[model samples]
Target chain A: MTYTEQLNAFYKMVSDECVQGVSLDCVIFGFHDTRLKVLLLRWKGTHEWCLPGGFIYKTESVDVAAERVLRERTGLDQLFLQQFHLFGDAVRYNREDTWQRQKMPMPFESRGWPERTLSIGYYAVVDQTKVMPTADFMTDECRWWEVSDLPSLLYDHRHIVEVALQTLRLQLSWQPIGLNLMPEKFTIPELQRLYEAVLGRSLDARNFHKKIMGLHILTRLDERRTGKAHKSPYLYQFDRENYKKALISGNLSFV
Target chain B: MTYTEQLNAFYKMVSDECVQGVSLDCVIFGFHDTRLKVLLLRWKGTHEWCLPGGFIYKTESVDVAAERVLRERTGLDQLFLQQFHLFGDAVRYNREDTWQRQKMPMPFESRGWPERTLSIGYYAVVDQTKVMPTADFMTDECRWWEVSDLPSLLYDHRHIVEVALQTLRLQLSWQPIGLNLMPEKFTIPELQRLYEAVLGRSLDARNFHKKIMGLHILTRLDERRTGKAHKSPYLYQFDRENYKKALISGNLSFV
Candidate 1:
């Protein structure tokens, strides 16, 4: 069966169950115009925008739940998603009076459960162009917001975001940072913007390029951007196999 | 009303009505007699030993459940316990069965509604001398086993212990180690044994001393061990303020 069928079957099985459970929320990070932005969804009945999230089934593994959430929200599975933290505050159960409640069916509203709900926070960085993320948009709208100045989120979501950010920072130092968040083929500037968004600071362009190119995780491609001016920047794609090997060997560090 | 009453009330109320859900299993690590070991418990009416674990309450945080399990098995609450990994395999649901297949109990040996059971793993290093392990020995028997030659465990518990071991190895590179698992005041060799246990290998003793002593997280306690046959080694304890400052500054990489 297809992924959609599997999801539909899962939803059919547990739509009205009253048992205690879990959901996966993705703080999908992306780079747009040199800024790091996160994907947030508006509710159908409320105006508040929150991170993209999905409920879990009794039969599903927690890792699979995270992958499914990533797939449902972005139409992109096998992306660089991670399970960084689990948020389980008892008060977070009452969604109607909390973060989900604030979402109005306006420009930025939420369409979530009306009962006791608990969730785990899974986050990912995807190449903005690779994701067709108008997913699950009913009366609710979806859009990206800058990381530095995030709109208030529901419940302890802000705290969840903080944990994700901390995990991202630590991971960056150990793993190659930009490849997961960017497209398969991209210019050096695109890679630079992704890092800038994540690090929330500017980096010396020449030095950043020198450091990244030195790692040899990328291979220069033949293609160039179509709708651009100035010298047509050359595109480079991640050397996947070598990068995986380098990752295991600790040759990649975010710093 | 005390915590036990509140917890017992919560447990009894949810036993029939709700999915009391997760259990927290601890894979506590220790360095003893030049070997690495983990704390284990053997359930009553069973011949095998397993990780000491218990259920989480509807209202209490998962971390609290782990702490309660630690206290229940070993009578240690104030030890250094950290959330290492979460095990949520679907195969884990038939866990009680794996524990009692051979004329033990019905589920492990009877019949009941299938309940989903995921577990969170926590590990702590404590002064074993202070712990008064379970006295009744009814539900289970508790003891510490050397990690190098661990007996096959119930369900995915052995996998859970492996995860804890990996987390400990990762923590060794950056976080302050040896202190919590050791006596308040210990010699340089004590710290070395811990590093070796966690890394599962040997290191140059002089280099290990240079690396640790260079960090300066230790306070030279004016004491020495009387029972040792070798030269009287100077004892040391963690400098609380220095440790806190190191944690805040994100300088705690040890692996």
Candidate 2:
């Protein structure tokens, strides 16, 4: 199909089934190489990046709509997706002219976008290696950027990202959901590094280890065998059953 | 003005200023006499009760709308309000006939409520004694109901209340926001009763006391002087400065 044909088809699809005044923007966080990252997308002809987002369908629950949007963008399913906040500022989309400046099709006004919108904010933690980020017809690139070093984002997404990070930090202090970012087996230092990245501070090694071990939710695995290391740290795996039980029993502090 | 005149004025005001597709429902929770209660309103001429709620104005944020609705219902400002969930099921208001059966005015349909609505759920903790619970033209009565014994509610309000309770329970495990429901000075047993009411389970007195005191957020006060009591239990006040500090430091576990 021609480029204009594709744009018309996209607009038609959105206008046909999408709910009038609601959208979902996802902050998909991943831990890789001891750094916390978030998935972002660049519109086909724009340098500005944005959180992967889409409109909610008329017949779909907001939760289902969020999950569908995330899966379509990341090609990963069943991640820990949570709704944290809703952004409904009156001027949330006042910068539609930016798309026109970028020489891209304007999806908002062209398709009779609702005069006002309430965008539901969802955050997900995923294993970075498992996701193969895909770019759609409207996206030129899709990639993960370190959370601490994000580029200027479109719309009010920068505020959304900041809030998502705050929510994740608050949630991490009480729940063990951060384990979703780790591989099947990881070293103690690796786990600590992930915490440090999320908390944006270096923790005392001894105190961190003591606190994590006291939770009784990790099973020690075989020692790492890196030849160049001074002394390889021991690897550990989350005891899924105990972790589930701890979550149910509550009061499992991680910070 | 006559009743019909008042109804028409209310509807006209709502339609004039409110956004078309979004609404805010507040689950105002209060603790009194060792029981957890929720503020509910009875639609005019109907027995059904519902969370005190209102639609967002075209120029207002959802958060502001929630706070406005809450303050209007409770006659209090700046309570511990937080957004918890969004209800967007396709059939959220499918039972419109419930209004017809009661011969009640349909504020939603009469005002051209959107084909689909996405109601944002906010939960607030307020001092029960401070609320006057005023009824509007559309409401015949407004009162508090025990969380465990709520009457039949309108639309999807029953589900909204259940989710609010769950959110409150989860939040109480990590934050000290529940102090909003208590008097300025309270006894240890009184605070424990609030926890018990929220959790719906009796906690061991010794364990509950030890855990609460360990947080170091309360200041001991002069003993209560109840004339008929076997013993006067000492009153305690939350150290407002330390409580604020603890909230900022971010690990004030209460449950």
Candidate 3:
């Protein structure tokens, strides 16, 4: 089907089976090459990029809807998704110029939709090696962009991304990071790099190592990383039982 | 106006000026008499109680709408309100028995509202002494109920309260509690009781005092509480500068 045909079918589905005026945006975080990356989509007929988002169906809860969107885009399920904030600014969806730039019909105005729409923002951390990024009918590209160097996002999505990162950084003080992003057996420096990426700053290596060790959630392996040039560092992996206990207690501190 | 007339006017106002299917609920919390309390409203002409909530106007943001609701209900402003979660279950508002129990009209069915309504949940901490609780047209009584001994709430409101309290307790690890709940000058035991109230558990007195002092957000006041038969304890006030810094950095760990 053509772009216009696909959009028609999408809008028809939205009208027939989805709840109006309620949507959700996902700021998917993945750690790759010592940098935090976010998943974004480029509109099918335009260069404009936005966070992967979708409308809530009338039958499913908002969380279920978010999980479905994640599964559709990443080909993965139950990937540590959390609701962070609700973006309900009056003019969040009032972007006519975006449509004109894409040369596509305005979805809301044509359908006599509500003047104000609200979006629930959710952030997910996923394993980059396991993801098969797929674009839906409305977008031509689905890929990861480094958080530090992102394109001009559509609507208030940039603000959404900023808040998601802020929430993630604050969450670091209470929850362990890189459980999904780290390899099963990795060096301490690898995990530290993931924390630095999310925090957008470097940390003193000795201090970070001490703090993480004191948390008692990691299990140091007998072997080293093996491929390093000089003094190879010991490998560590999350002790699943301790990690689960810390998650439920929410007492892991890493500042 | 009569109750039926008030209902008609509220529905008309919602249709004319508010965004349909999007609302907000505020879990107003106050610390009093060594207990954590939540502000709830008793529905007019019914025994049912629920969290104080209101609709969002098309011209306002959700936060602003929440503030408006708080101000209208408490007759006060500038409370420490934080958005914790969004409740968007498909059947969250589908309780037909509630209206049947009230022997009143089902407003949504009468007005053809959306099948799924999403509510943004915000929890606020306020000084109980300063509030002048007031009821709106739909409610006849506004009062605080001890969190441990709350009445059966309407719809899914009991679940909302549970989630709000859980979020508040989790946040206690990263943020200082009792900034709004405590008096200007308080003893360490007084503040510790406030923390216990929110966490629903006890902390060792020496451990809590040591941990709170280590955060460096309080100033040891020379003044002591008078009019006590026992040895009076010294009072301490939160140092605003340090509290502000800790809040921004989010590194204050109490657990």
Candidate 4:
């Protein structure tokens, strides 16, 4: 009938004929209060925790499947999710604890799910404060764990997490999506702390300040860190228009 | 029969139990004589060039699928293969003009027989000199095309090639896989040209030289480019140990 209806029909047709063979694993990275975190779920059969994950229909693109998983798991709409790595070790599905062997209703699914399931790991740096975490579909619970305290995980998931962190570390050098991880307005120390957490190393306070101030990505806000500090650091908010322009041309370098 | 034979017997018992739906498409990259090149396959149906691809059996891992694809197509036994992107768009299969829809037995498998198929794209940065370019199984012919002048391709292969280029461009900063694309010993100008080709822009020769030399990944050889009229640039080879160390642990700033 209309353009929307035609578009819907196209989507329906695609899913029917495409023979989809894909799924999403979200390396949901979040920074809450001060510590950097990743969203993980205690898997169904075991005590091991893993980043939220699910299978993509035989008809969806890996990117769209990833986004769907992120939104479905976190209850965050349109969170900035990035597909970072694909875990394709042949024995990745050998474990008796994997969700794949759980008799999914989709008959042609993981039935003979390859001995190694190829999982496309997607990273989403979400605003922990803004988004409500909901674990409805297949997770026992979805909560942010300090990156440092990540427990034993299943399969090559540990490696996947490591890769996602590596990608995040690289992204931090050029793209300052850290603002999304923090509040609308954050202090200098908060910004520095987030960077240190992501980088997993200490930065020279003065140098970090100089770098941030030089980029001018942040505008000074009329507030301070408010708690116990020798000097209350000035609050800063991101300059969205400038950031978007820098991002679009792919010039979001902070280093 | 022994337990080993029992395990083998069991494996055969369930070999058909797996559900296979995934595939790997390699956007093999190379730098030949200073021009950025990509390894492409010319299918029999049309002259359209496409990445060498293969399906992951219900029993194999993604990496195995890629390696098998390489072995099946180029006769490359081993090379530096990496999975960079996964193209799972539902409509990626049904594109008109150049897809091999007739030879394939099924949309997914039906290999050897002429057919239509949807494939995932993995990228490999290989020593092109090592690839035998031997035809195997379903492929007609394989050729290395200059990345800048890639021919009309099938499906989402163009996007896959672009993604591989992006991966290489980003990886060039941390890892000196640039060496993999070059001859054993290359002059400074040769190396510079390689970077310029992949980056698709002219870098200041002096500054580029300074930065590359400073990375300490190159070992100057005891020879020079003889044909040049100007000062013969000394030959250099990448110091793999240092490059590997840097790649594994260091933070990269190059955008």
Query: What RMSD does model 3 have?
Result: 3.0
Chain B TM-score of candidate number 3: 0.95
After superposition, the stretches of candidate 1 with alpha carbons farther than 4 Å from their true spots are: A1-19, A93-96, A103-116, A135-139, A222-232, B1-19, B93-104, B108-113, B135-138
Give the lowest summed-lDDT range of ten residues in model 4 chain B. B105-114
Off by over 4 Å in 3: A183-188, A203-239, B184-189, B202-225, B231-242
Per-residue alpha-carbon lDDT of model 3 for A7-53, expressed as tens digits?
A: 77788788778877778999999988999999999987788899999
Best by TM-score: 3
Tens digit of lDDT per residue, candidate 2, span B1-255? 977678777767766778766778999999888999999999877787888999888778788888888878888897789888888777786556666644555455666555677798999998898888987777889999999899988878999999999999887866776469988888889999999999899999999888888878898987784775578888898988888877777576665
Q: What TM-score would candidate 1 get against the native?
A: 0.86
Model 4 quality (TM-score)? 0.80
| lDDT of candidate 4 at residue A144, scale 0 to 100 | 78
Instruction: Using TM-score, rank the candidates from best to worst.
Output: 3, 1, 2, 4
TM-score for candidate 2: 0.86
Distance from true location, Cα of A143 in model 4, Å: 2.3
Q: What is the lDDT of residue A67 in candidate 1?
A: 87
Candidate 1 residue-wise lDDT, A68-118, digit = tens: 877777788777877776665555544456633763222111222223344
Q: Where's the lowest-lDDT run of ten residues in candidate 1 chain A?
A: A105-114
Which residue runs does candidate 4 get wrong by more than 4 Å?
A: A1-21, A43-48, A97-115, A137-140, A223-233, A249-255, B1-19, B99-119, B224-234, B249-255
Among the candidates, what TM-score does chain A have in each? 0.80, 0.94, 0.94, 0.80
Error of 3 at B66 (Å): 0.4
Chain B TM-score, structure 4:
0.79
Tens-digit lDDT string for candidate 1 (B1-255) = 643454355456545443346567888776777788888766555666678777666666767667887888787777788886666665663555674532233331122333566677788877655666672333446777899898757767788888888878877777776667776777888778878877988889888888888777888877886686878888888887887776667576655
> Residue B132 error for model 4, in Å?
2.6
Winner by lDDT between candidate 4 and candidate 3: 3
